[model samples]
Target: MYVPNHLKWRILLAQELKQAYFERENSLRNCKRIFELYGRYLLGTTYDTFLTYLNQRKYRIDNLRMPPYIVAAIGLLEPLRIASERLRLRKMGSPWTLQEIVEEVLTILRERSSTPLDRRIGQAQQHVE
Candidate 1:
């Protein structure tokens, strides 16, 4: 939940591209407010989380303003995450089962979706079809 040292930075300048979407005056608050990328837990606010979405985007002298969208190698990153979690569990000598792993992996991916799932993964019917 801690902001990494590398991600923390002070605003030397503020440029609001949005049409009055932000209070330009707030950026000129004239204070050395400390901002650690609250969400910048790992790689400058993407690898980990700590702040809620509202707080993450709400700009303040002390808040970190992340990009509107982030392009990630999720296809690779997600599988990597799955593999890493598996590796950690394996190292901890957690009992292993493909079924449990399958369920956990699905849950991890589902967490990414803000909407209900519409696709199937390894349904038996699909294999038969």
Candidate 2:
């Protein structure tokens, strides 16, 4: 299914926030408190900005679902979490550049071919091997 890039970013951000906060505390209260405390940093923008961006893109923020782009972003961010502290301590690069993220998401979608012909070709090749 086709998914918007912004939705992907939102999903990745949500996953990262969950991992960073709720994974350790494992409490809804703690999760909520942590979300309130660090949500701005995790989201990379203010709530108003987020809403505005979504609105500009004609995307509904209320029903955002996790897209493949977001899944890829989460994969990328997993390793970076180790350096998150250092990042906070010093000025650093953006975690996910707009161009890079979009490119990655597109690449992922392009690579996700599921055509019967493609599968047949793959099966034929497997038989040959």
Candidate 3:
């Protein structure tokens, strides 16, 4: 099954935070704040709930070291990405259900999780070329 982009972004942000910045309490706090803020905006869920969900899945950010800037970027990009996906779904006019949207987003997330940096950059290059 495909993971949605929104979910993918969340996972990526979490992973980055965990891997790169969770070591320091300060960094963890920043990452937590960013996650809560953006997660609320995008998923209509509270930060605590998001944290709970991660915990349920055994996802931990402790001991990671994500830069504050990158965390901020993830927080900034998530809502924009969700809005874009929603707009595209609306334009497509197929399976206009929220469930469909969620599924599509999940699929995108799953696919993108495995996407390499170079491929992502290449895709960006194509967009600007």
Which candidate number maximizes TM-score?
2
Please list the residue runs of candidate 3 whose C-alpha ends up more than 4 Å from where it truly belongs after superposition.
1-28, 58-129
The best-first sequence of candidates by lDDT reads 3, 2, 1
The all-Cα superposition gives candidate 1 an RMSD in Å to the true structure of 14.9
1-129 per-residue lDDT for model 3 (tens digits): 655544545654545534432334375476576565455664566667666545544444344455688766654364446755775767775545666655666666677678999999997677555
Residue-wise lDDT of candidate 2 within 1-129, one digit each (tens)?
656875566644654556544444345565555455555566666655533443354544545556667555655453344344444455355574556545554555455444577797986577556
TM-score, one value per model: 0.24, 0.29, 0.29
The pairs that clash in candidate 1 are: 37-40, 40-45
Query: 3-75 in candidate 1: lDDT tens per residue?
Result: 5433233121112211112233453231111113112322233221322322344434455453443222323
Better of 1 and 2 by lDDT: 2
Q: Scored by CA lDDT, what does every candidate get?
A: 0.38, 0.53, 0.57
Candidate 2: pairs in clash: none
Residue 30 in candidate 3, Cα distance off native in Å: 2.1
Residue 120 C-alpha lDDT in model 1: 40
Q: In candidate 2, where is summed lDDT lowest over 10 consecutive residues?
A: 50-59
